[model samples]
Target: MPKTAALCISVLGTGNIGSTFAFQLARTGQHDVTVIARPGSTRLQQLQRDNGITNHRGEHAELRVAASLDEQQPYDVVIVTVLAHQVAAVLPALQRSAAKCVLFMFNTFDPEQLQAAVGEERCAFGMPFVQAHVNEAGTLKATIGAGGQKSRLSQQRWVAMFKAAGLPAVFEPDMPLWLRCHSPLCVAFESASVLAVRRGGGASWQQAMRIARGVHECFVLIQGLGYRPYPSSKKWLAASPAWVLAFVLWLLSKNFTFRELLAGGVAECHALIGVMIAAALQTSVPVNVAAIQAMNPTA
Candidate 1:
């Protein structure tokens, strides 16, 4: 791809993350953005008819929408933003595409399977810093973290492309570890939120302490496995007093906005917890994750 010519980017999955990305790319007009959704998807039809998708702030842009990946006309980059549990279903399709780089932009405790599916050379990993959701009206309401900054696993051509489009991108050298460390904290809070639902109201002090303890254990387990918690911010869980952290968790759990988001992602949260627990067990590190495990007994 030429520096001056627009990059051909295909965003697979039409969920909150994918749609938000596609919208941002379209607004930049520096790339030929194509959004691929499953056939028979009403969202795809709406996007095609309207020539774009709208955001909660009423922002909109015209962009291409497709139902399948174009094998013959290769894309410069293809971003996969589906749920982690759903990644396997799309691997074969992505492997058959001629796109030079395929970026997986979702959470997963294990990335080896993805790396194996798409040849490591062509695989890239990224995590969206934005929190977005599709409302009933189908408009995307998103809160871009740190003013639209995103984290990538490496510095590559795709990173340059993202930066050129006004999306700040930073390279995280230990991304796999980053994701692993992140999983526990994410699962703990989300699990606590679900527990709140079971309790028939907001999060209680006991539930908050349980989550804080669970997170602290995860941090210990990560260290026992010979890896420093990636993203130093997580180190706080280990460094801070238990009561302090629990208080913070309690406050977050009571927030209406946070509860709403957690409610919508309960399924994904459970799946991630299962994967994280499995990974921890494999390390043979005697870490007590009972609080976390109790969140999803079936898993």
Candidate 2:
């Protein structure tokens, strides 16, 4: 692809991840970016009124807002940044769109279902590594990756696009396994944080220990299902003694930033835990996910 060739891109959803990505991509000014939001939704009106999105520091990036994907003028790429449980709602639109590629950038343990819904050739997978949230004022508070930090994606073109837009991207050959491995760690962190909040304070050392143990079990379950945790570093969770991992979690819980991130992601974490537990059950793996399950029993 030519560096100057403008790619038409559409972002589905107006949540933190979607808004943050749109802001970054719009800053490049090389691509024609449009955000697809629900018709007559407040977010759509906000985006249209603001004529752009602003970051926490008040940095702005102009973008186009649309009510739906235009089948007549298909986008070069459509990035889905909805929560794991919300992907199904947008499948019909994506399937009918003229987009050449559809990148799912969220946490999910069931990629095969999404692939089947969208067609394997057009479906791609990625995970945004930014900490972002949309405030009541519609400002996107985001801490995007810098230096060597980059988000994970599976396609070359998408990776190049993100990098060119100043958002670093790294390719993961086995995204499904990568996501599967990451699911439990995310659940554990959120569960610990929820427990902390419920207890009216940050995570205690004991709560951190329980979270570490939950992560260890999840890693074991992944191995039992005949998949090695991707990125290799996660293998350390299984390798380290429970006490050491607990100490690390305890230390991390003290950080205000980490706690805030956990709070924001608790809902998605609960959803993913359900998916992971279901996946484990299908494999006849007698995994102990009670800790994760207990995180959000009402869900």
Model 1 poorest ten-residue lDDT run:
290-299
Estimate candidate 2's RMSD in Å.
2.5
lDDT of 2 by residue, 161-219 (tens): 88887677888988877888888777767766666666656778777777777777778
Candidate 2's displacement at residue 227, Å, is: 1.2
Clash pairs (backbone) in predicted model 1: none
lDDT of 1 by residue, 69-145 (tens): 88776787889998888887788888888888888887877777888887888888887776788876778876665
Q: All candidates' TM-scores?
A: 0.85, 0.90
The segments of candidate 1 whose C-alpha lies over 4 angstroms from its true place after superposition are 1-5, 56-59, 145-153, 196-201, 239-241, 297-299
lDDT of 2 at 282: 74
The candidate that achieves the highest TM-score relative to the unseen native structure:
2
Candidate 2, 224: how far from true, in Å? Answer: 2.8
